[model samples]
Target: MSDTQFLAGPALRRLRRREGLTQAAMAARIGVSPSYLNLIERNQRPLTARLVVSLAEQFDFDPRSLRQDEAVGGVEGLRRRLSDERFADLGIDRDEIAEWLAAAPQAALAFARLYDAAGQGQAATPAAIDPMDLARREIERWRNHFADLDIAAEELAEELRLSNPDITAALTDRLRQKHQISVRILPVDVMPDALRRLDLHARQLQLSEMLDPASRAFNIAVQLALLEQRDAIAGIANGAQFSAGQQGGQGAQRAAWRLFRRHLAGYFAAAVLMPYGRFMRACEATGYDFTILQRRFNVGFEQLAHRLTTLQRVGQRGLPFFMARIDRAGQFSKRYAGASGTLMLETEATCPLWVAHAAFDHAGRICTQVVSLEETPGSPQRWFTIARTVEGSGGNGGGAADAARFVVVLGVEAGQGAALAAARGVDLSASGAVAIGMGCARCPQADCRQRSLPPRGKTLVFDERARGLTPFEFQR
Candidate 1:
């Protein structure tokens, strides 16, 4: 494709505007220059491989977005184009071409334009659609389903603690004794045919066809419940609150309930493995150390952190706390809480200052940091928060079993330990309690270098004379 035909100039411009970045700001992020970026955006340049990766990381833009060609301008064909007959006589060395791609993007774009139009001015074929976007949507469906299952899981977790002490092992055993079935993973190609039995035997047991691994695990887990712990599982799901669609109609709500039920079964399994009272006692004894808990209980960090939030029940509640798990790039993997007052609706995605980022830095190191937050009086109700980062391993070989670094955070009212630790006199300054933005919009503290947008429910007052320590202006 010709350079002009494929270069997605409009979308690139829009993304820059949305991020509130000028060409110079973008250049600083990707280590380029204003004039160079300008030339590229104006269809005078083509993108390079290294720059493509840089753009993806810096702006958090999807890699697929740039590859759209018609949307962000593809530059992969630049090298071949530069090696064309038009350039052969020009004596442009490959080293010079590579250097221009990295150092002088403007010149590279100029070359791309000449080459793109040289051969019949045809445009390159558009890239395939992003699987991650679809994956994200699917993931969201699963998440909302889990959210709906929260109340049920909480109850089952509690019930299993009181009654069926070893749910996971017990369930695993039951499946073995009754059905004569062995657990095994089959490849995707054969999975659909391998588990071809969706046949239900009197509601006590059933098989599902063509289920994904996660979905299959859930179906089997649920069947295990019906076969062995029917009374308890039913009691939990039946008694838990169901919002409209969760009553089993078609849509996201019903999906959430099903996911929730499946998740509840797992929670029951975990609770069976590490009963609540026992786990809570271990936590207190170890000063909330994750590794010690993991070793003591034979559970993973993600499981341990998740179980921590579920430690709330009548007469058995631990200190009320919120829990979130984030990776090195600030991707939140899990969020859960039994706290009544804390707002825990995926808030981690909005707050980057929380120590979660630092957790991915150095593996196996626990960092205890303080956070300072303020409640808002605006329409949506917001908070300004400060957090600390701790690092850990993601297991080995970078697999699911790999030791993953994770961050845990709790909402501190005025007097919470983590909160007080961040107060002016509590002495957490050595722990790096720098102020940061919250959820993009809800953050109230201004003068923040991290401010992506004006704080919600507050007016933006630009101050040229006396800038607050943060970066933006704030009002009472």
Candidate 2:
């Protein structure tokens, strides 16, 4: 019935402490009981409008300062960060997070800083969150399709007489036969800042000696990928039909080219390391247990997941999955979807309720949820989602906090959800489907209590006479 809220408790307590007044004195000034003031100070009660007006009139405390400081103190950002599944087991609630954010904004922000520092990886920055940010949109655009590249890689492997596990040997032979380039592992110091570099004039490829066996092998495989799929990658890049502002210029063209090249190179590298046939069999046998596959191939979880998304070779297709990777802040650094709809997000996360954040809670554990998103008009996109939180090897002496942490989500569609039942150890779809929208600003669902803001087409009407539970009600 009232627009008044109890958000300013932290600020009020601070003011009382600063003024050296007891709760009784403060309550007398604000025309409230000492017991009620205790609840207000402890955030048990809200800073009422009447109390605020009385404080302004009696104690001369600025009402504007109380509102500004209180609003700024809420831990909405931290809540979003904690939604990462690594911290899922903590069982933190909104109230606790809000108290932390309000009582010590600096400490809360410092933790955020620590999180971002630790989560430094191939993450898309906040600038990429803007809908019209072309370079980022170009990058995300190229992320979806490795289907074409998968075919090309398979063809190249056949041409080079290659097979898996003995990838280094295959790479060496392929290099010599196809490109006449020799592979060498040079000292890390000699390689400068690069892990792998091509000395084309010398007709040689050099890999940094500092890399372990798996990484060293991957370097060669990536070079082979570049050599094998260069033409296809180039075609995809140049053929991408961007709009007038993003495409007509040489700079945008070059950016698009880089995006495709990187995507294809990664795809080809994964293909070479984990050949499609072998990888598919592994997935089928294990029911997509990534842990077993990761060890069998000696590849990272990210690599395993990326390879899975590329399992779209026409006759030999795996699940049509939507893979999204995000950093600690829940910003979508990379996202790829196969066969069906696309998740064109304005932010890395649409709501705190999304399991992308929950991945941080359980840390090393796998978390699954059955969610439905109405991205399309009539057809709702359902995902029996699987997510895992990945942590960087806390090697070196930098301590555990220095290790980068991120989450990877792989979502399989309707019929596909049943296939992962073996790996999940239960019926994933048994949870039924939790209804969701694309985003608060972009989504059309009007009745969602989880919406942080109203949809773009609607406006909040301010009524001086009445207040409802929600901030706004739509007319359209």
Candidate 3:
């Protein structure tokens, strides 16, 4: 809407054909010339706002259908796909990819699918497929939003009349009255193996004493989702095409499907705890202050961070936030990109310069940074990132040293950073930003002191007489 052209030629052509209307007839109905309509259908011209309104009014269809779905990998996604080293010599530009998407989105999607298959080393057998990757792909396919589950959770939240001060009591009482499952908090020594366990035979929901109030409520919500929203979760999971030809074996497919369903149940649990409408209002009112929102919602840091990524409901959309959590060893435990389209989330190797990695050093405190990523020269993408360390559920017996730690990092586009209270007074300008990359291998940044590996596709330079700031010296 900000003067960005909407060129959905393929969609328009398909709509006209589906309606059995000739170009001239459609043009007349839309108050545009036949030639202009042809141009629009062929991707030579963008759809005017007036024409879109007229088409919607005359056709009685939603205007949202004219735009490409983010799930099919929009311009940013296609650009990332084209940046692969295999296509390095192609020298394809962003504008051409954008036009290609508008002209033939199905073909673009097909290309993306082929790219993904090739990345998987052309797995011929079902057993060769990685179930976890399949689950992650399903989540990314929908941008982490499950509309049906969201609505159901919102309704359930309202019926429960959830309040932050006694959310645990409310959930426990609901489980007890509705499902006849009583909640019991067991001592750590008694239930040392698991945090939360449901005994269907005993009609008891046992929770380890290790869990805090937030976690207790969360586990209860998860139980409720599995019991109440099982059908909805399964319906959503069934729609995911984990393999290209559904060739995966039953075991592999079941593993992927179960993982996907578990994540969906968690999504429903978060939605019930933090209903979309109320959460959106709180986010806007508090300027997205994580601390205040966490307290207000009675949720933990990770729960709040995960919920922030799913605020993509239509007409009440929140900022497109991408989240990632990593341990001290730089291993990513969780990652979700809710339409932010930042390419950094696509890879596991994270740059050490990122504040998320630095958050481990400054435990229990929030760290904010404005970083720039130049995937290509002369076009830098900026992001405002917030990172904070959370105590992992390693049990009290492990002590502080044995207890694991994780850094939850949330990021949004720098242009929207001003809306976040944490980014206030932080310079969002390009010059003030710390230039980071995907990782040492994929990064082309020269002379970075923290770089552990040479950049990919660069020739290593060896000189006995001198050494640079970084350990590896490579050709730029």
Candidate 4:
């Protein structure tokens, strides 16, 4: 279940070489023939769980380390390096690059470096990237749903609690009894990089002193999920591996594991805090009042929004919501859609009219509107969108007010907007849905007043005397 169908031929060969053993010797030790090992080395066969355990027992190798996607970071380096528009028609997607990394990591790293070197100054600036982005995109492609983890988390939520109460205590007790680990809060100066650290040798789990009470509780819940619900996460990940196919490379697999753990943790925490049955009733009764629900669960806006996206448990499902959070610069830091065919653009924002762009001006005020995508005018993808500014903890110097402002936008497709408290008085059937664009490069609107650049596929015409709202006139 732990993505055991990994094409670990490269890994196996590496291990054999590292141990200074020949194919026959290594194969004999692992209870396999040299010819069989040869097939694995060539990536023609997947390493079975039985063989993996045998190797671990014989060589004292950490199975986890062996299974980890080596040069996974290099895959990202390659992605960023190759994403330069210079190689726009490279004929290989990110998944193909991931496959190259898995099949041959050394070559992949070398290729990434070469690609980076070649793209000297091509105007297509590589965006600041999250290491987990590859996995995030892959998960989003699947609509952020992991049936196994969701089912298990829901069951665990019901078994663990009565209502939205005592989450930290419950998780702490679980850790203490199940994993023999005690939770402790430590200063940020002591543990800087991470909010939580597990000291397995000392049987202690450390939470950063910098985190708020709710965050501290969430950290505890996450650790509990990792310790208790590991198998569920692995099962979902294994399933993703086959479904992913080419994307299920070494680096991508590594990222997938992290995303699965993070997602499973979130699901578990949300389930515990907002019990499915109870939360469903509350959501309907309160008309999905976000702030009210946030108070009831003692979770942050981001957490509340994330939990709302996962309310797809068949009979007690809530509105199919799509939520995203971005910095003032319009970089999406977090994103999820409950259903497919999202109206939100995943790429850079070129449209100044999007409510998220306006959210920065009106801090703390929820801005809601029924808007349609500018790319497809009068398209049925019109969504009821609400955006607001959220301030993070300003730990560097000033107070919380000085912290970075992130805009959180939550939207539901046209028909479901009326049930939302934020959507009050919004006409779902209105023809006045404002058109939006993906970005300047992708937008085809010839009449955009604020257009910065012409669409990629169109030829821009320059006129000497005549001036229009757009600087460039396209040739159809």
Find the candidate with the highest lDDT and give its number. 3
Distance from true position, residue 10, model 3, in Å?
4.8
Per-prediction tally of clashes: 35, 21, 0, 1
> How does residue 446 of candidate 2 score in lDDT?
61
Model 1, span 370-473: residue lDDT tens:
55443212212222222333333212223344334455554433344432223434444324445444465656565566666665556567767786665556
User: Which segments of candidate 4 are over 4 A away from where they belong?
Assistant: 1-133, 162-164, 242-249, 374-380, 391-402
Best by TM-score: 3
Q: Write the per-residue lDDT of candidate 3 for residues 383-465, one digit (tens) a residue.
A: 99999988776345334676778899999999999999998899998888999987777787888888888877778998899
Model 3, residue 431: C-alpha shift (Å) = 2.3
lDDT of 4 by residue, 1-476 (tens): 35466676777788899999999999888898999999988888888888877888899677765544433333444554454434443445656776776787666655643443232232222332233554564465455555566666667666556533476777677788878999988877787767778999999999877777777777777777777777777666665521122222344456656776677677776666676777888899999998888888787776777777777776767887888888877788777755634635455563677888898888778888777763222233578888887766423323455456788888888788888887777777658577677777766667878788787766778788899887878875
Instruction: Give each model's whole-structure lDDT.
Output: 0.47, 0.65, 0.83, 0.68
How much does each candidate deviate from the true structure in C-alpha RMSD? Answer: 22.3, 22.8, 4.2, 11.3
What's each prediction's TM-score? 0.47, 0.59, 0.85, 0.67
| Model 2 per-residue lDDT tens digits across residues 1-476 | 35586566767887888889999998887778999999887777777777776776776566776644222223444554554434434657667776687566556755754543333221334322232233333444443446677666666556545353365687787787789999888874687567778999989998776555667667788887777677877777676543223213445446555765677687788886787887889888987877789788777767777777767676887887778787767677667654433442434455556777788887777787777775434345667777888654322223366556788878777557777743355444535777776556655566667777776655556788986566666654
For candidate 1, give the lDDT. 0.47
Q: What ranking of all candidate models by lDDT puts the best one first? A: 3, 4, 2, 1
lDDT at residue 307 of model 2 (Cα atoms): 76
Clashes of 2: 21
Query: Worst lDDT window (10 residues) for model 2?
Result: 120-129
